[model samples]
Target: MSSLYDLAGPADAGAPGPSDPSDPSDPSGARDVVAFARVAAAAGLGARWPGQVALLGPGAAGAAAGSLLGGAVEPASLDLSAVLDRSAAGGLVDVEFDDAAAVRAGLACGGRASILVQPIGALPPEVLSALAHRRPTAVLTRLDDPALPTRAPAPPGDPAYGDPDSPDSLARSLLERGEPADAVAETASGRMLVSVYVPAPHLVVVGSGALATALGAQLALLGWSSAEVTGLDDALAAVDALGPGDGVLMVDHSADVDGPVLARALRGGVGYVAALGSRRTQAARRERLRAIGVDEASIERLRGPAGLDIGSRTPAEIAVAIVAEMLSVRASTSGAALRDTTGHLNAGRP
Candidate 1:
C-alpha cells in the first residue's frame, strides 16, 4: 500500500552527501530543485561534468545543470561551453545515449540524468498528486525503446476537454495515456526520454466571481494554480481540485456573497486571503464578522483594497495591478519599479 514516493525514496534519493537528520529544512520532504543549481555551481562540478543529473536528495534541493551533466559524462571535466541541452522546469530528468555531451540545466528546468529512466515503475495516483506539490520526482528513459509510457504527476486538473478518440492524451493520465507503463524502461533504451513534472509553485483561486474569473485568467499566464467558484459549493469544488503548495484565493467583491465564504476559506488554512474592496467596505465586513463572534486577530489578516495602490481605474487594469502585487508578495519585493527605485537597503557594498 506504499506509494512510489515511499518506494523510490523520493526523487533526490540518489543525490550526494548525508541529509540533515535533526530537522528537515524544507516543508516538503523532497529536495528544493532550484537550490540544487546553486549547490552544483558552487561544488566545482558545474564545469566538469559531461552530461549528468545531480540528485540533491530529500529535504534538500533539486539538481543543477552540472549535476545532470556529471551523470552523462565524467564529473572530473565539467566545462562551461559543452553544448548543454536543458529541458523545462519542474523535476525533469533526461536519459541520453550519448555519453559525450555536456548536459546542464537552469532552475525550473527538470530533466533527470541518464540512469533511472526506463524502470521508474508504477506509482499511486494520490502519491503522484502529492509528488506534484513540491516533491522531487525522478523519471527514467530507455535510450533503446520509445513505446514506453512515462509517468508524471497528473496534470494539475481534470481534462480541459473529455473526448474519446480525440487523439489528444490530455485526458489520459500521465502514466496511462501513452506508451504502456510496462514499456517505460524498454522504450528509453531505444532513444526516447521521459521527464517528470515535479510539483512547482501554484495558487488555487476558490470562488467563482468577477474576481475569481479575473484571477484565474491572470494567474494562468503567471504559471500559478487558479480556479473559480460562484458559491461556497464552487469554492469547495475548486479546493478539491487543487494540489498542494496551492491555496484558495477568495475574491469576495460582494459582501453578501463573500462573508461566509471568506470565513470558511480562512479557516481552511488558505495561504493568501484578500477581499476586493475599499478599507471601509472591508472594515464593515469585519464588524459584521465581529457580530458573529469572529475575533479581530483572526480577521485582521485580510488585505483590503486587495492590490497595491497603483492608481488603477479600469477593472482590467485593476486586475493587472492585483496580480502584480501578488507576484511582488511572492518574490518578496517592495512593489516598487526598478526605474523609480532609490537605493536598495538590502544591497551590500561590493
Candidate 2:
C-alpha cells in the first residue's frame, strides 16, 4: 500500500468516525473506508446515495467528474480522452479539456478543470457517513497545494459539512436539489469544490408475503433503506416517515390488507405508489377505492399491476420490475427502453 499525507484538515479525535485515523491497525486507509461504509449503511443510508468523491486543487486541467455524479469510485472519462488516455491512472491530473461536455453532463460548473481526483473510498468518514444516511453533506476540499493522500482526513471545523442546525451550512442550501450542487466557490484556502450529496428518496414496502420479502432484499442490494409495513398500524406509522423523496408499494394479495395503507400513503403525498396484481384486480381495487371516496386524483396516483412490462414471472423478477419502474419515476424517465431513448444516459439525475 502507498503512504501519503493528509488531504483534509485535521478533525477532532472524538468525532463520529468509523475508525480512528491515527490507529496503527490499518495505516493504509483501507479499514476506514470499509468501516465507514458499514456504519453508514447500517444507519439507513438511502439507495441513491452517490459515491463520496472529491476534486481538489487550483483549476488546471483535463478530467471529468461524471463518475463522481454517478457515485462511481473512479473519475469520469474526459472529452480530452485522446490527450491523456492514461493520466488518471494515478487519480490526479492537471490537464485541460477542449469542451465543457463533462460539465454539461453534470459536474462542477466549468469547462476549465484541474484537480486531484480523490477516490470514493478515500473520502472522509464524516462526508461518507452523511452520504450514507442521506444527510445533506458539503465536501469542502482545500486546494492551495492539492495532493492526493493515501489517507483522507476528516475536515477540521469551520463550514459544517452535514450540520443541519447551522443556518449557513451548505446542507441547508443544498436541500433544493437531489443531485449535487455542482459549483466552485472561493474559500480562505483557495478555490474549493463544493459537491453536495442529498439523501435518496425512501421506499416503503407494505405487505408481509414473499413479494415483500423479495422487495426488501432487492432494495438492500440497491443501497436503499425501506420500511416494511405489514398492517394498518405499521402503515400509518410509516406515513409519518414519508417525505417528498419517499414512495410506497403494496404487495399483499388482499385489498383489505393493502387498501388502507395504500390510501394513507397516497394521501401523504409520496412520490410513487404502486400495488402488485393483475389488470382486472387493479380495476376492482380502483372501484373499491372509489367506493371509499378515494377521489379521481388520488386514484390516478396509484399504479396498479406495478412494475414495467418486463414479463417478469417470479417474485424476485417482479421485485426487479417494480423497482425499475420506481427508479424511472424518480428519474422522470418514460421507463422506456434505453435503446429507444436519446440523450446522455445520466441525464436528469436527482
Candidate 3:
C-alpha cells in the first residue's frame, strides 16, 4: 500500500511542483518528515490560504494528516474521493469507516476519522519548521469547528498547556510519550485531533565491515537514516547529538574507542546503545567502561552482543536480527514471536 514514504510529486505541468521526499538535497540527507514538509511547502500548502488547496486528515490510517495540494494528497492511501467530492466547496468533512470498510481502505482496524477538507491551511510556518528540523512537534486541530484556527505545533513549554482541557495540553501529553502517534481527544473547545511527530530513528554505526554495509542497507530499507563514523571524535559527536528516538551501534571492537562513545550514549538521551562482541569481549569492555567512570546503571543500558538469538550467521542475516532487535527495543518488546505472546498484535507500536 502507498505510505507517506511512497508519496511522489505531481508530474503534470502547472501542478504542485515535483518533490522527492527522500531527496539528498535535504540538509540531514535523511529520508524523514522534513522531506514531506518540504513537499507540502513547495506545493504552497504550508501557509494560510483561501484557495482550492485542502488537507486530508489522519495520515496513514489515522496516524497524522497530510496536505492535499493542487488536488494531490501528499501522504494518503485511503480513497478520499467521496470526501473530496462532498467538500469541493472547501469546508470540513468527517469520515467513519466500519470494519470491512476500514480493512478495504488499508487500515489495520476499524474506526471513525474526521478529515478537514478545507482550503484553510492546517500547519503554520513554525510548526512546519519544527517538523522539518526534527524537533518534537504536535499539531492540534479542532475537528468540530473549522472556523477556529488550528493551534500551532508547540514544545512542552508552550503556555497553551496551562489549560488542562485545552488541545495543546493534550498534544503535550502525547509529545511526552516520546513517540510518533495521533489521537482524537475531547477538549474544552470540542473534539480535537492531535498528531505528534518526533525525529525518525537515526543510527550511528561506529565501525566498518560487511556488517556495517549490511546495516546501512537495512536502515535504508526501513526508511531510517544512519551515519557511518570510525574516528572517536566523530563517533562521540554523533552520540552526543542523538535524541531519545536515535540509536548507536558500535562494531569497532576496540575498548579504547568503544568505551567513551558507549558511555556517552548511555548517559545521554540516545534510546538504543548496542555493541557487537562475544561474551569475553563484552565483559572486558564492561570493565573498561567501569575504569572510565561509567556508572553501573549506565553500563547496564548497553546491549552488548547486539541482535536477538535468531541463530544468524551471514552478514545480511545478522543485520536483519540486529535491526529486528533495535525495533523491538524501540517498541519496548522482548523480541518474542507473535504466536508466543498474547493481546494486540500491534500493542507496542508507535
Candidate 4:
C-alpha cells in the first residue's frame, strides 16, 4: 500500500502543485490537512462522493482515516486500500486491533477502535480553515450519531463552543484543557469523541545573538519552529501574525524594539509572550511599557526573565529552560516537577 505522503505528491514540488504536506519537517501538521483538502478537492471527492471525506483514528492518540483525507492515522502500517474503497462508498467501518496487530499498525497499544469512514460535510469551513492555519481546533463526534459531527475552534472565548449551556460543553472543556489528543466525553446529549488538534508551537525570536541562535536550535530539536528578527517592523509583523498556539520572545533588550512588539503580543491572542532580562531590566521595561500606554492587565501577561529558575547560565541551557517554560504554559501547568506534584504524570498528555 502507498503511504499518504507518497499518494499526495512530492514533498518539495515547485509552486502551484500538490505536494506531501505530511513531511515530518513541517512540524505544525497544518500542511497535512491543507494538502489533503487540496487533493480531495482536485480528485472531485467532495462533489463525486455523497459527503466530505476524512479519517478518524482511535484512542487518545487520535488516528483517523477517511475517503481520501487522513487525519493523524499513518497510512503506511495499516493497509488502507480496502478501507478507502469502503469509505468512498460512504460506508462506516469499525477497525479493532489486537496487541500485536496494534504494534504492526503503528499504534502504541491495541484496542477496539471505530474508525469513522464517512462524510465530513458537517464540519464547518471555518474549522478546516483554522486547522490549516495551525490554530487550535476540536472535532466533536457523537457516538450515537457519528455521521454528522460538529466542530469548534478551541480557543476559550469562541462563542460556538464556549457557552457552558451548550450541549457539547464537556467537549469544549476538554478542548480548553489544551490537550491535543482524542478523548471520550459524556455530554448532556450523548457520548462524544473529542478530537483536539493543536499546532506545534512557533516562536518569534526578536533579536540576533548567541542566545537567539541557541534558541532556534533548541526549538528545532523540540519539533517546533522559530523566526528571528531584529527590526521593529519585522518584529511587530511577526507578533501580529501569531495565533493562539504561537508565541513571541523578545531577546533584544532595546526599549525601542521590545516595547511595541511586547504591547502587540500581550494585547493579542498569542499564547505566550516572554522576554530575556534581569529583574531590574524587567522593571525598567515595565515602566517603559506603562509610559507608552500599555495597560496593566496586558503588561501582566508578559513572562519576563523568560524561563524557569533552572540555574541556566549558558546560552544553550537558557534555551532549554525557556522552551521548557513555554511548553508548561502551553499545557496550562505550573511547571512544577512531577515528583513534587501528586497526580498522574501522563494525565492530559497524548
lDDT of 4: 0.60
Residue-level error in angstroms, candidate 4, position 213? 3.7
* Collision count for each candidate, in order: 56, 11, 2, 8
Prediction 3 TM-score vs. true:
0.60
lDDT top scorer: 3
Best by TM-score: 4
Pairwise lDDT winner, candidates 1 and 4:
4
TM-score of 4: 0.64
Q: How much is the lDDT of residue 226 in candidate 2?
A: 72
Candidate 3 residue spans exceeding 4 A from truth: 1-71, 74-135, 141-165, 176-179, 182-193
Give one digit per residue, the lDDT tens place, for model 2 in 127-169: 5444332345555444443352322222446444445443225
Question: Candidate 2: global Cα-lDDT?
Answer: 0.52
Q: List runs of model 4 lying over 4 Å from the truth.
A: 1-73, 76-101, 104-112, 117-122, 129-135, 142-167, 184-191, 220-223, 331-350
Candidate 4 lDDT for residue 20: 23
> Candidates ranked by lDDT, best first?
3, 4, 2, 1
State the C-alpha lDDT per candidate.
0.41, 0.52, 0.61, 0.60
Better of 1 and 2 by lDDT: 2
TM-score of each: 0.44, 0.50, 0.60, 0.64
